[model samples]
Target: MARETWGTRIGFILAAVGSAIGLGNIWRFPFQVSQEGGAAFMVMYLAFIILIGFPAMLAEFVVGRKTELNTVGAIRDFAGGYWQYLGGLFVFIGFVILSYYSVIGGWVLRYILGSVTGGYAATESAAAYFGMVATGTDTLIAHAVFMLLVIGIVALGIQQGIELGVKVMVPAILAIFGILAVYAFTLPGAGEAYAYYLSPDIGYIMQNWQSLVPAAAGQGFFTLSLGMGVMITYASYLGDDKNLGIDGISIVVLNTSVSILTGLVVFPILFSAGVDPATSGPGAIFVSIAEAVLDLPFGRVVGLLFFLTVAIAALSSAISLIEVVVSYAIDEFGMDRVKATVIAGVAIFILGVPVTMNTVFINLYDILAAQILLVLGGVLLMVLVSWLHAGEAIEELEQGIGDLGSIGSLWIWMVRVPVILVLLVSLYLGVTGYIDFLTGAFAEYLGTL
Candidate 1:
């Protein structure tokens, strides 16, 4: 059998963007913005995306296209020897991420149903409702259901399944969020929310620059889905004619737009309801924001749209996460796509069971995947592409980017110096104390009453 490739360029671009625009955009990004200094964080994040994220993305693309293999196969084939372990490390990272990621997907699915049934409407407190829902057998059922949806799409193979799924999902995500943003702008306190979100406080940034830069840079990598092998697996299917640099830029632009638009939608709704935007945890969305939505005119309808949009975004990203492992299985072991997807999905589902049952475990898994492994994977990737395989990476990049004369060298140097340095700092922060900070925050939030 022949290897699968995307049917069109737009399909590939949308699929990549779909992977990038997940819960990170809707649930995490807004919270991070509020916590890290609002507009100051946004400015720093955008800078990292351009300087570090885009170049690193191009490096992944070059590796994938050069070898036409999954992460394991690509590294082994391209560099040979001990480098294959790095590939296996990526697979491990993807597995760890999807394990807990599906649990969040399940939560989003529950919210989608809750919005329609007014499940949240009857609750006296959104926080209490979320606490109840976040545990027990019901959460496990939801997680399984969400995992099965991801499996079904991935099992259909690349073009017919993953590509087709994202083609529909990505458009729906943008349209729903766009409509919600427009509606949010009409709310009573929208102007204040917009100012809070868009107005950068340089003094705040200067005072908090040490902590803020690491958080923003980590988010930049996370939001782009750069470190987990999703981009590498997606790019492995690409042909030589496509311009990877241009596609990388497009994906970043679309992903950033969705994230910014989510802030536009979420902040106004929270501000209008007199809810504080700084409730910077999972509860912010499930409890605080949901409670706010219930109080507004036509609140049920708005809630439905919001959760539906999140559900789509979650599914789009979950599909890509599963694909990273599935692609590796197919490429390295020559396993059947259906078998690989089923085995991987079931394993992830089983792994997520504990996460659904225990809030503490859930936080641990999230910190591991989001903070530690993500930055490690990114730093290793930069070293591989920029240092060890620079010649081949540049050659692969030049294949489609022939018209750009000096851009290839510029990309290489950027990856080698600025990108690698930033990723290393991100990893250092995560290792030294960031995990403790996150764990402490989770403890404080979860321990209350």
Candidate 2:
């Protein structure tokens, strides 16, 4: 059978954008901004996105569109030899990420239902309410439901499954977010939130650069969906006529816009409620937003829309992550799409069981998948495209964009040197942090013994 291709250029762009915009943008971005000194982290993140993220994205695009294969086959066909194993790492990263990611999606789902029934709004304490639903039997059921939803979408094939779903969900996501942002602007503390969110603190960044750099870089890579073969898988469905450069730019722009918009909605609501945004930690979105909505006149409506937006965004990104492994199975093993999706979905759900049982596992899985694996996968891809297969990669890149000008060489040089250097620094910091965490946990356990 011939491989599936995207229905139109717009469909391809929307699908890629959907993958880029996920929980990382809506759920995690706010806490990261609040913790990293507001605009300081945003400044560093945007710098990395433009400098490293865009270039790394195009490198994956070149590999995918050139070979017209999944990540595993693409690498093996293009570079040959033991390097094929590196593509497997990308697939594993996607699987690992989606495991815990679905748990958060489940939380969003419960919040949506709670909005309609006034279940969560009536609670006396936001933290206590969140604690009740964030883990245990209910969370496990939600995780399974979210995974099933993801599997169903992927089983439908490219045009009907992934493309069509994003075509609707992405537009709805953008529109709902816009509505929320407008509402947030009328809040009492909007001015204070905007100042804090938009103002850069150079002094703080200089002092906290070591820790903040890796955090910002990780967020940049995570939000863009760069390192987990998502871009590669999406690009594989495109024809040579499609301009990879333009598509990549569109994904980055739209994804970043959503991230900023999320901060607009989140920070304003929290500030208006006279709450500290960073103190809530991972539960910030649920706790802060739930409390904000509970006190408003049409609290139920606001809560419903907010959680619905989050659910849609989460679903869109989850589809892409599962598709990475499903595509690999279909291309390499010649498996049916439906069967592949089901098998991959089940395995990922089983892996997520631990995450739902303990919140600590969520943080551990996130650190491993987002901070460590993503940076390593991204840097390897840069090496593969820029150094290992520089000639062919550039040739593939120039196909739809016309003659090779100075910009082509510049992109290549950027990925080869500075991009790799930044990723290596981020990777080093991530590993060191994980080790320190482990050491601290061990010492604490020994004290109890």
Clashing pairs in 2: none
Task: Provide TM-scores for the models.
Answer: 0.96, 0.98
Q: Candidate 1 residues 348-393, lDDT tens each? A: 8888889888877765776667767888888888898888888888
* Best prediction by TM-score: 2
Error of 1 at 367 (Å): 2.3
Tell me how candidate 2 scores on lDDT: 0.90
| Model 1's TM-score against the true structure | 0.96
Best-performing candidate as measured by lDDT: 2
RMSD of each: 2.0, 1.2
- Mark the regions of model 1 whose C-alpha exceeds 4 Å error after superposition: 438-449
* Model 1 clashes, total count: 0
Candidate 1 lDDT at 439 equals 69
